[model samples]
Target: MRRNWIIAEFTYDDLIAVYIVDVSQVRGNLKQIDNSRLDVTYEYYPNDVDVFIFQYSVDLFMSDGFPILERPILNKLYERKSLYSRSGYGRVANQVYFMVEFPYRKCGLLSYLNPREEQLFQRWGAKEIHLTAAWDGKVIWRRFGYQPPEDEFAILGLRYQHWATIHGIEYQEPQNINDFPEEFLKDDCVKLITMYKVLEECI
Candidate 1:
């Protein structure tokens, strides 16, 4: 039987030790899905104290019974690379916070994974989460409640104007994700900005 193993451990307190074990269990559960195997790395930075990073990647294959071309997009072979970090301070002192970087996964897989990850974050006392949304993620992450910081709204408005001018579309300042023009959704060439959520809003 395959099992999840720790690549490294640098625990300074009970909280971090428990967090590490929780991550291992999550990895094990991930492996059970479609008999997929995952490579996970967990690291703790002592110099920064209270900073931890976790990364994992997996490639899932479809069953032979499924027709290659007919397979749903979600079931098609795709690699997922995700990175997460926890910090002690951000917008508050001694806060448990998370920064999600370069997380790319199919919607179906994310449906299975996000709740589990959120549970871990909540248990670890996460107060905020930040991430940069890219590609289709700009839409997906917004649906998950991440929004641009207050200061970023102006910058996004400027970007919207630029895109509208290039695409010959009407320009309207977008104050939030919902206000963005439809063209922004279809244009992958447009760059997205960082988004964040205060945990209290969701929890």
Candidate 2:
């Protein structure tokens, strides 16, 4: 009922590591840091209120190619904010999905501290971390021993009809961005790409 988070920042050697933990769990010991070497900061984020930390592209759904969208119109919907997984736990109980990892770059290896982060998430009682990544995200995740089960998909597609109505954009089931009126592309264009990963350990 009370969703809580603990964000911690530490300087380990040259890497300035920052991570989040869910405070809901009562089991497991929090990682012990060497006080002399530790320089850290902490913050809290609560549940009940959904937090939006980043924006994602809906560009892939704009036009279909490999792993084409099932329904371009239904699949173009987008949510401006990311939320905690009801499954619970991970970075802020997977509370806020940040658009931190992408095709251009990926989450870096935390060296020896990687285990500590995992232990922290386990301590926080996270069942899994859910996220949507571009198709290429699979390559990035695979290096970490995690892979998105779904190859291509979409989220927040229901808003398409309403968006079209307000923008005066024509409705088409098999939506194509090219067919869109010039004004629609200029005013309310949307896109998407490979939607990957949902409810999986993010270690």
Candidate 3:
């Protein structure tokens, strides 16, 4: 009935939302992620952990403007790939987690995947799907037909410092979402989408 937050200590602040993908409904969604030209890959982890990783570069801001968001990710792309290759495992993931970072503002991630990737997951048995992002980013998700969970941080046993560490970013844990820095809250933040709704839509 509820989602699980899989928090890992990484070079970046990452809060992977874990979900069980409906075996029957994921085929089409898989196709969508595959068809889209995004660099995506998944690694298998033994003992029931599956790691899915994806990367896409976009020019969200002018080529020269410091590009606060892009720099860190762009720089660590190779390192991440290397790390996943070493520790990631392959299996019919009954549970899946996605950590995607959107263009600036600050601190949040996305779960938007292309067709091929989704297909691979479906083929493997991706049952549970989890999403994590900044509090403000929930607004962006709503625009995309996603209904987010309320108070995910409290519900998921997660906090801002954990998120900051996962992404290797500086994080000042806010006592309340409203207390977030105006600049950071100006753009996307973390959020999640459940598999039940995903199935409902596919149906």
Candidate 4:
């Protein structure tokens, strides 16, 4: 049950810890990533792998400011299950890899997303999710809960006044979980999109 680091080209220097999500329970617990087990190459890691999902969390410092710990999913290894696309834009997502980056801090490319990444998130019932600097903006990160309630960057980006009018949280980002049968939020999100200032003030 142990191996050596096989994929050598994609190692991030500041990575603090590696974890594998054990879905054997409700979703699952994060098992610390074992560098020794990194022995499997990408070719086999996502290919022959099945039955468990992995998340890599790293503690990073953005700049001379404070140190914040954010989770950039390194890879989502999904077990091969029957897949059907309702919207006509569906395809088999063997496994998905996510690449993350922090524009500043001199830190380089944080991680990589392999394929069908978004589909996997939607399938398992994520509230709202995001990929940093990835065009989609906060639209994705809002999955778990409320994430600052605006589709703008964390630093210098200004919030668009039309947030409420934008769309409901469920609609902007929908999940397949039973908890949120209506994954799309109501017109509240859309309305907020238009009046971001008001929402900001209330928050």
Among these predictions, the greatest TM-score belongs to: 1
Tens-place lDDT per residue, model 2, 1-203, is 11232122222221223222222321122222122332232233333455422211111111112211122101111112242323323332232222321321222312233344445444433444344433333233334333322222122223445567886867664232223343432332333222222334434
Candidate 3 lDDT, 1-203, residue by residue in tens: 11232213221111111222222333322322221222222332322223343322222222243332333222001111111112442222222223233433322223332233334334333332233333544444334333333454344225445555666867765543443444433433333423111311121
Predicted candidate 1 versus true structure: per-residue lDDT over 46-142, tens digit per residue: 2234334333222332233221112222111001112122333432112122222222233244444445444444444455556666566677767
After superposing candidate 3, which stretches have Cα over 4 Å from the reference? 1-41, 47-120, 149-197, 200-203
Name the TM-score of candidate 2. 0.30
Candidates' C-alpha lDDT: 0.44, 0.30, 0.31, 0.27
Specify the poorest-scoring 10-residue window by lDDT in model 4.
Answer: 194-203
Give the better candidate number (3 or 4) by TM-score: 3
Instruction: State the local distance difference test value for candidate 3.
Output: 0.31
- Check candidate 1 and list the clashing pairs: none
| Candidate 3 global TM-score | 0.28
Q: What does candidate 1 score on TM?
A: 0.54
Please rank every candidate by lDDT, starting with the best: 1, 3, 2, 4
| lDDT digits (tens) for residues 83-137 of candidate 4 | 2222222212222233333332112121112112333344433322322322222
Off by over 4 Å in 4: 1-52, 68-75, 82-203
Candidate 2 error regions (>4 Å)? 1-39, 47-92, 95-108, 131-138, 149-203
- Sort by TM-score, top down from the best: 1, 2, 3, 4
- Report per-prediction Cα RMSD to one decimal: 10.5, 16.7, 15.6, 16.5
Candidate number with the higher TM-score (2 or 3): 2
Every model's TM-score: 0.54, 0.30, 0.28, 0.24
